[model samples]
Target chain A: MKELTILSGKGGAGKTSVAASIASVAQNAVLCDDDVDAADLHLIFKPEVKEVHRFEGGQVAVIDEEKCTNCGICWSYCRFDAIHTKAGSGFYINAYQCEGCRLCERVCPSKAIHSYRNNNNYWFVSDSRFGPFVHAKMGAGEDNSGKLVATVRQKAREIATETNAEFIINDGPPGIGCPAISSISGVDAVLLVVEPTRSGLHDAQRLVSLTNSFNVPVYGFINKYDINLQVSETIEAFLNKNHIPLLGRWNFDVNIVKAMLEKMSVVEFAPEGETAREVKKVWEQLKSLMLTD
Target chain B: MKTLITSTTSTPEGPFDKRFGRAAWFCVLDEKTGESTFIKNENAEGQSGIGTKTAEKVVELGVGKVISGDFGPKAKKLLDKFGVQMVIINEDLKVIDIINRIKG
Candidate 1:
């Protein structure tokens, strides 16, 4: 199956909206939201969760007060300063500052320290209107979002392969950080959702170079291209210089937000609308490119 | 007793590496003989877990003490488990300088 990720280096670049609409057109595709930190695609798909799996991001050390010996070995050895003393309770581990390395647990001479896994993160397999969907939720200030992205993508791939689906489309996270890298890695192609703003072009440039480094073929569409005609021209010029294919130039429409409020993808929300037609064309272009191989 | 010092190069005169896990080389010094040997860190440029991997290697090398600019939390934990002493020296000294000072 062909795997494609929708990415924009900058946030609010319409990655989720564009990806979700494209999923409606790519009817045989398995869809996944790789942005675990602040996932939004589920709002459009309205998935019914089939499986829920907890993710242990890392281990946090805990001190047992019953052991009674106020030994300071754990306190001294804690590189993260996670171990702190309370007035009557003695030492306690600060879950926030804890790096979850379990150093203090190993160093405690009295064996008062033990480690526990942080299970605040979870991934899900679900049935959406678009097909099997995989997504995740990360706890606030949780570590290992990158690993969680991998897990979500893995589940999506397994489901796609099992169902013999034609495509695996991911709504990727913003920026060139860990989660973004995890989202794009080993994917057959990347669909860049570029917004026509100076900052949008700037961030898309970074994302473009990153895709280049990963050697992933990139196809793009300018979301809200009419919002800034001059910047759109510049962005188009840049994409042309880099030899990245431009599939469609879309207009800025309030219908996107209206479609979300109605809990529908653009294609489903407005079947005969201009945006839906363009998105369908985008999907057709993407399918020809990915299926050509 | 043997002590390990993180270094930027595989030479006694090379600048000491401030970072522990990403150091280019580690200089192992035999305190009794005042002899030092350099071992390149193969996992220096690796992504994630290199600190713990390097710590495991140091424990396998059977060093009594380790000196570096800083230690990652995971590395510090693993080394402490094996009773490997960690010494953080923030000074910009050469590997030979650390060896002489520690030997003395």
Candidate 2:
């Protein structure tokens, strides 16, 4: 099956907006939203979960106050400073601070420190209007996001295989971090969704460098291109210089936010509008490219 | 007393691992004498792909224990598999002093 990952270098660059729009137009497609940390695609997709699975990303160390001695061993031993005393009574592991290293747990003479598999993260396979959606939720102040990304992708792959779908479209996370890397690796092509701004251009550069390093085929699209005509021009030129395919440019349109408010993809809400037209063109291009390749 | 300083960043002065995004440095020190040796992390492995594969390399550094800035669940799991000690560093502090303090 051919896979196309929709990625943005920074957040709030309309990556999900574009993904959802394109998803509405695709046939025989499985949508995988890999932004497990701050998953907002559900806000639009309104998925009905068909499966829920535990994701064991790592462990978090905690101290048992009842176990007697507060000899301060764990406090001093923690390199991440995850241990802190609350009300001077006993030590507590700051969930956000804890990296689940288990050092303090091992050194405690009183055997107070204990490590447990954190259950703060979870993944799901749900039925959306578009089809099966593979997604997840990582608890606030949690680690192991990259693992969660991998989990959702694996689920998406499975669903695609079972349903014999021809395509898997992933809405990837922002940044060049573990989650982003997880989404891009081994994908057939990367559909990079870039916004028109100075920082957007810079982040796009970094993301391009990251993708090229992996030797992945990349296609570029500029969201809200009309807002900064000059920068959009620059982005097109940059993509051309990198020899990446320019799928098309989408102009700034409030109908997108309106579509969200109506709980519908822009393509579904205004099938003949400018945004919908561009999205359809992009989808057709991807479909033909996959067929040819 | 033995102490370990770990970072996700890899550097030539210390161990260099590409798997980590600047969180791949681990410097083990002798708490009593203040002498330290670098683990030479050939790859700063994150919790994905070959980066996840480097957990064994990190275990080979022979640290009696470690204090680190951040570690993912996979790395923590591998560390458990190798029986390496781990301490979580929640705040930004002097890496050396934290190591010495943990050794005591």
Using TM-score as the measure, the top candidate is 2
Of the true interface contacts, the fraction found in model 2 is: 0.14
Query: Tens-digit lDDT track for model 1 on A14-114?
Result: 88889889999887889989877678999889899999998877677778889838878888888887878998857788888998777787777788888
Decoy 1 TM-score against native: 0.70
- For all candidates, state DockQ relative to the true structure: 0.02, 0.07
Q: Write the per-residue lDDT of candidate 2 for residues A1-293, one digit (tens) a residue.
A: 77789998888889989999988999889999997668888888999998898777678887777994878888898999788888957778897788877888888998877888778678888999998998888777765456566567767866887899988999998788778877765566789888999999999999998887554578999999999999999999999999989998788899999999998899999889999999999989988876665
Please name the candidate that would achieve the greatest lDDT relative to the true structure.
Answer: 1
- Cα distance off (Å), candidate 2, residue B5: 37
| Each model's lDDT | 0.82, 0.75
Give me the runs in candidate 1 sitting further than 4 Å from their true place. A68-81, B1-104
Q: Evaluated on chain B only, what are the TM-scores of all the candidate structures, in order? A: 0.97, 0.64
CAPRI band of model 1? Answer: incorrect
